[model samples]
Target: MISGLIMDIMGLHRFAFHSQVGYTWVILAFVHLVFNWGKVKAYWRHRFRLHPHQDLPTPPKQLQQLEHTQKSDRRSLFFSLLAMAGGFILGRLLPTGQTVDFSSQKTDGGMFYHQWSKLGYPQALRAILNWGEQPARYKTYGDARQIELPDPKGYQGLSLESAIATRRSQRDYLNAPLSLVDLSRLLHLACGITHAPGELRAAPSAGALYPLEVYPVVHRVEGLQSGIYHYAIQQHKLELLQPGDFRAAVVTAGLGQNFLGQASVCFVISGIFQRTRWKYHERTYRYVLMEAGHMGQNLYLGATSLGLGACAIGAFLDDALNHLLGLDGQKEAALYLITVGRVETG
Candidate 1:
């Protein structure tokens, strides 16, 4: 079991079988203890010298043996504690040595990152150095014009099961304008602040560090300008980044997907790496992409629940989309795109 655990921690073996072995070992250990319950009880009493009157009168040789055993146990416990304390102190005092840059490694990039980010003893110790002030949770544009989105609550939509059953990647959309309320609800259900005190959202984030920024490139939303706008999650409002038509640019950025131009709103999801990177370190890339997936699924279900169409786009020109969103394609970069609009039904 110990060997399996070590292998799993080091990313040297699959954890499913290792975990099964561990669980089975635990069950066997439990059964062994059950069968030896009386022996275990007697040993515990002898070890701790509990209830001396209940124990048999010991021979002089047995008495000496017990004394020696007690002394050895005491020494073992003292040394064990001392070793733990010394290890902790050394880990804290020692500077982290040079870490290999996984990006420059000749190994497969994804596998290299996986192995490098594996949480082992050394990596856990190095994490102590990563502690400090956390980055701001929300990205804001204070000077940009903000549009008040309608109260997204109290809208009766499809049941959860129905939504999941009907949810699909819909690329074909009708040439009709989407209502402002529909847009409001979509954004709300996607990543709105669900718990105000904790600043939690509709989608779960790693450590609640919401690194995602949502930008809606409006094409035909009613009572809204045709331009790019950021969703202000804290205030539940839309912040207009640029007020102009970008249908052509969005289609080009989306690799000439005509459906992007046809959709009423194309949601661009970007991740601010430092938000999660400060805490997660090497695992930051994994967490940010996972958070993006959570947000994307929420959008998919939300669109489906509202009886609208939504399609996720992954094959987009990253640099082009980043440039369009005024992102530097480093600290904050576009990760995924989902286009939502009205769809024809039979």
Candidate 2:
């Protein structure tokens, strides 16, 4: 209990230690029950009148002793109940605004959101009565410089099985510019629309509502300037949002992860939650994060297929990244990042 309290104070997780202690406690309790099995049986038989047919006459002194034992047991049970009630009240009195990361001052947002988004009777009724209107399926940049990408098909390198087998989280990268076609292929396979008719994408999205938006922070790619570009998924083109070197900015936004600056491109995946929120309601957050994971895995496999290194990064300054992509961090926010780069191979 003291160790758990210390961990809580330090903002470190105590689940592992709590789990071990819980198991040990259960084993010790079982052993205790075994050792006192005879006494337990006697108490149970007396309490339940196990032998109703047999009338066992009791001595006066023994009867007094039995009554005293029963009173003590009742008192113990009463005190245990009272202690539990006190603990519950104490938990209710504790502050709920505690921050998760001491350095960033980032509160336990996930836990807060999880509790807020629970589907109770009232929430279920609200969902049924007023399902909000859905947002547009695709995001576009009107005046941004558009770069037509090479056909994302027919230029495959490795087989599906081979790609899966060789897929790894590679952090170390070589200082080499990636081919334009390879970049195109990576973006397409990550989340591009594979089926044009229904707007189905490579990564599976809940309710066919693609809430994710992909932005590539380009470091070095052939024929493309070092800048931040948004992937126009519908047209399979790149829309250059900011055309300048962003290696330093990206490195800072990624919490000083130098690999993000060294990589050929870092794909920043954001979610416009309203797209899924209209339909999924309370569970929208869960679905949006799951979709990001699906897209990240796709990027991993795609990079592996092209014999390149790929690393999915979840640790980063959320506000800084959203600012870099011109997102407001609320209606639309960055959720995941994947860095793809050239690597030495045998």
lDDT of 1 by residue, 1-346 (tens): 3333334334432335665876898899999999999999987677767335346777878678777887787788789898777766765565443333444556455765676686657567446455456778888899999999999999889999999998889999999999999999999999998888898899999998899999999999999999999999999999999999899999999999999999999999999999888888878899999999999999999999999999999999999999999999998999999999999764
lDDT (C-alpha) at residue 289 in model 2: 98
lDDT of every model, 2 decimals: 0.86, 0.85
Which residue runs does candidate 1 get wrong by more than 4 Å? Answer: 1-107, 128-133
TM-scores, all candidates, are: 0.69, 0.67
Candidate 2 accuracy as TM-score: 0.67
Lowest-lDDT window of 10 residues in candidate 1?
Answer: 1-10
Worst 10 residues of 2 by lDDT: 5-14
Scored by lDDT, the top model is 1
lDDT of 2 at 153: 91
- Candidate 2: where are CA atoms >4 Å away? 1-109, 115-123, 128-131
